[model samples]
Target chain A: MNPSNNNIETQDDIGTTGHEWDGITELNYPCPRWWVWIFLGTIVWAVGYWYIYPAWPVISGDSERGGTKGVMEWTQYKQLEESQSEIFSRRAENLEKLQNTSTKDVMDMPELYEFAVVGGKSAFKENCAQCHGSGGGGAKGYPNLNDDDWLWGGSLKELSKTIKYGIRSDHKNTRNSVMPPLAAVMGKDSVTKVSRYVAGLSKGSSSTAEGAKEYKQMCSACHGVNGEGNRIFGAPKLSDGIWLYGKGDEQQIESQIKSPQHGVMPAWIDRLGEDTIKQLVVYVYSLGGGE
Target chain B: MLEKHKKLEKNSILLLIFIIITISIGGLIEIVPLFRLETTIEPVKGIRPYTPLELAGQDVYIREGCYGCHSQQIRALRDEVERYGHYSLAAESMYDHPFQWGSKRTGPDLARVGGKYSDSWHVQHMINPQEYVPESIMPSYSHMATSKASLDDIGSHLEALRVTGVPYTDSMIENAYTDAMAQANEGEANTKDGLLKRYGKNTIVRDFDGKAGFVSELDAIISYLQVLGTMADLKDYNPDVVE
Candidate 1:
């Protein structure tokens, strides 16, 4: 066959797409072999995917009817349940042991203690770490778990109770205390004097401070006669330097005395279930502050 | 096949028609299921439409672009379930008009942030997030505290949402402004009783922004935040059994 003839009309000839731009004809070459194979492969894969997974919508009056259940009969919730069950199964033995063991007895079982600590640390990071620091060092108002100071007691049983029924939480059994605004009850001047007296207590000042008289008259009941905190009232130990609102300076003390700000922690029993709370109590105890 | 294709390729309208048909096949498959299927949303109790104040707050949430950083949907994954609590149910946000199931998560999921913190904590966090959370990148919304919530057109908003299938009663629309005010000043003598009567008893009516007189934008937002996932009592829901 002649080259010119083949180019124009012969069966052996390559063809143009019958279009021209600036006197150049477009070639109508087939797609690349790999590209065509991949394109076809994707279509086949998609068909397989649709067959194995939910793909089509079916009309059904029943609210439970989602769609056409593929051969795999898989769902996101089922996948989550399976994955979560795997995790639970892995921890089941330890969790059951911890569940059986009382909060006080958890300390005695070293293996269970280690499990609780690890589990509790993870749970705390997910929940409590946002408010209380990740290291349990505590923010200004948030109580530090690592320190000996606790608004409530620091024993394992106390920690568990506090964690379950939070201080000033909405829980019916939540620990409650109210230091009536001293500035409102007594004069502002008296509040200032009392604040100075309380501030001086942590500094080891002489008991005969300027506001010593006011302290005995107004604040002695809940905050003991010597500024020692009363656990019953969840009051801060005044002898120590730890302050919930701010640094225990005169101004901070004065501000707190004038308008007492009660820190609120959410009750975790409903949120974190009993088993998890048990683990958390142990974890917090291991943080070096358990009494 | 090559010879037959030349006739169709030569015609622009035919090519366009074929393209439309190709695209519609994918679109119909993806979208039709959502409407046709009955179980797209699980049937759970207590999933009600937002109260007027909460609705106003939702508008504020959208206006301020809270969805830019915070996603309301928690995926059904092990970590997400463990962290955010029970994997988010479809029914949890079924009443959401343009659901705030955001794709991006610059901040943590706000799916079950309701009842997680106290009203005061929410107020403080909103005012200055960095003060409480030292490493937070969230900006302060202190301006919302001072800015009064716009309640004048709240009825119209309810009406608009009503047209889009939300079951807003005529009385609810009429009492929209009062209800917004009532929600913010909960404990005052007779204000909240009507609100509680209208919305469910579980509706938490409180001084969300710590200001009682007028409904501030902060109050609206906080009220909205406080009600996020507190609605559906999850104990009644069991995932293992499909209902």
Candidate 2:
């Protein structure tokens, strides 16, 4: 090593500290080289990222040139639209046929039946499932669509009629018969006798004298002479043990005969198309009673 | 004074930013429509809608606010299965616009209650709530038992409902002809064809005996009641594989 006169011949092992603090202490040190590189890279990437996506709140409308449209211009709303379209395409073919075909033709297509089943389940959920459960099972006063016993006939045709022309609703051309209030027609006391006699019908017992006459004139019109229910009227068989609201004990029957009952189903023609209703009929029919 | 105040402001500003960011994250998570799973069923499956009359009964149920006490859905709990039936399937309420998974257990669930009672029974119960069940919280809807309807419409209106998605077909529309004949027998001259043209050919009526005309909207409503919970096809609907 050279003596103090030659500057290039210095032999210090460590690098220089730009500033000296208090004699021998040093103040400066370079950060690690890798760290410096990464830091710079991140800053650069951020600038590019900001340019590409809508990372910032947008204030401009569609007219701005470079005012918005963060380079890619992608949006969640658009992504949702695209995904929905993809799902819709799978349904489109079936739905198209449905919209075009008459419901009768729709029924003939067993494959369409399969499609209808799939479609009907969801439609039923949206349209009929509120009163009828997801599976067409009903509640205390509500009738189950999945059962073999139908107040109305269980045939697809019969089911369809019921759906199209709802009962007791304000719908135009609604199904019409009204149970005259027994109290309205028969004096209050007669109601008791009639209800009891009507109760006897379920047991296949003869109606009391007053009941026999009232049954012939009033009840037999819908309930049938033998007390078997008219599926057409949706009147239940008197004999069946299955009670919707309750069974025909003396008071129960008296209350019923005194006042005819009203149950209501909303119309679905405008809500669910005819084919879908038919499909629901098929689905319901397929559930318990096909015969 | 300016320097001291600026220092204080800086400290508060940083605190505010941290709080805002934390709250924003929490808000976002809560806003998401957290999808939950109960049971599994294919999204697009088929089953029949209730008939017009049966559908009418459902309308009656709703009109009377039966949904308040009775739920059509049976939960997956053991008590529900025992009290109602098998667990209420998602498939059961698929067609319902507003599912009737009742909020309370005031009355038993009627998920599978169609044909569970005779028409007269329903009639009686509606007339006097306590007549059948010694202890019932329901108020008798005796008004429904009479022709004095709180609401109207049973056929064409149902056609409108059919548009909602309960399933109607052309043959069913033709049945309107037989239905019209039945209506005639019931003392109305309207033919199914005439009704069909107006309600559109898809109108469905379940009164197979063609005794439709005599059926007031009330009869139709009762018909709706008659068809509840009848969809028990173990073969078509294999419970084991429904999921």
Candidate 3:
């Protein structure tokens, strides 16, 4: 085929190849010089990439060793360790301070308190926020950390002990208590009467509900004569009206009297170490409800 | 060379063969490594098969589509490691017939939720997630508390898992029903030793759902959740060894 014999002309005037089907001709469009170079460059780059990274599996005798461990020998765990070490180095001063100071003493040091609060906030979100509200607002069954109504005392030492060992937890030294179902031992009528009297105490109405005698005999061992809760037994202050289960209505009170629900908090000492627990104590104490 | 190419293009069979060969290079690169999975998975100690109760609970987990919200695999990123304990290991889910290393995280990663909360917390959380976690979008599984776990098919389930390399022994399969019951009724003394003998001593035995008459679906699921990433003691884990 001759160039002069063509009726159509391309913009670049590039010649067509001698291949044709029907009336159409195959144009000899050369790829851009830069693109052709880049195409070949990527092939070379791929070989280098494979060499630098764990790319191909290697079979040695009967076993298959995962891959060539790369020239950089980069493992994800190593990267994680590197990043974590960076964080650790940055917080080394605070971490040391946190370790040295007791949880109670952490409050006195402004710098330490700030460090602990920050650390404890993140730790609480990870661990405690699920049960205890994100802002320390207690849920229906869970106790509120923002109020002075503490079931097992709210002093820094008390809070620290509770946080460390946990209430009704599996920990060997867990603050354990059980309010046995009174309906079985005492008659159901007596339980209802006692519940009504207890409910009346929180309402500020000194009603002589018939269960006052039963309350003194059975419940007063843990709950005081005036319904003040005992920290030793972890009994709630009935007079304060801060209910842990349901609203302290007559029915709710009666249900609790029948079969009390015991809440369990896992021991955090095994999980969050003493330093973290100390930090948590400072953070909790700072939450306004701390005694 | 141009004329030779024209001849090659004209022959469809030859073109097809070349296309196959070209595609196979990419295909082989992606697939052949999977055949050597033994090498790819690092050897880690203390990764054991799920006990009968745990396996049953895992079935409940699958049935409920818990993986839709919760991811079991924690990535190798720093933030994820700090939040969800150690990054997940392949050996951890080796026994998982269909692994639950989910992609979407509607809920937090459950890779290391084991022993994080008490059994009672799990019971409450499962009954009503919003009651414990007000911000949680998780649905209530309160019905599970009432429904009894199916003990009849437990042995057959173990046998099926055995077919997929779970290493459930014949005796384990035989006592699967009893073992599931024993796990839920921890107070029963006779079945305790047998369960311990079968599934290591570290196996947690308790009335997980705080109910006793029959093993509830709640018990199975709680048992599964309680043992999620507690298998391996990561302190002894050496990530340097790729074996």
List-wise, what DockQ does each model earn?
A: 0.58, 0.02, 0.61
Model 1 vs. true fold: TM: 0.88
**Order the candidates by lDDT, highest first — what do you get?**
3, 1, 2
CAPRI quality level assigned to candidate 2 from its DockQ score:
incorrect
Every candidate's lDDT: 0.84, 0.58, 0.86
Q: Write out the backbone clash pairs for model 1.
A: none
Error of 2 at A78 (Å): 3.7
Question: Every prediction's TM-score for the first chain?
Answer: 0.89, 0.64, 0.86
TM-scores for all predictions: 0.88, 0.44, 0.87
- TM-score of decoy 2: 0.44
For residue A146, model 2's alpha carbon misses the true position, in angstroms, by 3.6
Model 3 per-residue lDDT tens digits across residues B1-243: 988898779899999999999999999988887777777666777888888899889999999999998999999998998787778988899999899999989999998888888888888888888887877889989999998877689899899988988888998999888888888984356997898899998888889998768898989989999999988877777866544
lDDT of 3: 0.86
DockQ of 2: 0.02
Specify the highest-DockQ model's number.
3
Could you give candidate 2's per-residue lDDT for residues B64-131 as a string of tens digits? 77888887776555444433444555656755545667887687677766544444455656667565
Indicate which candidate wins on TM-score.
Answer: 1
In candidate 1, chain A reaches a TM of: 0.89
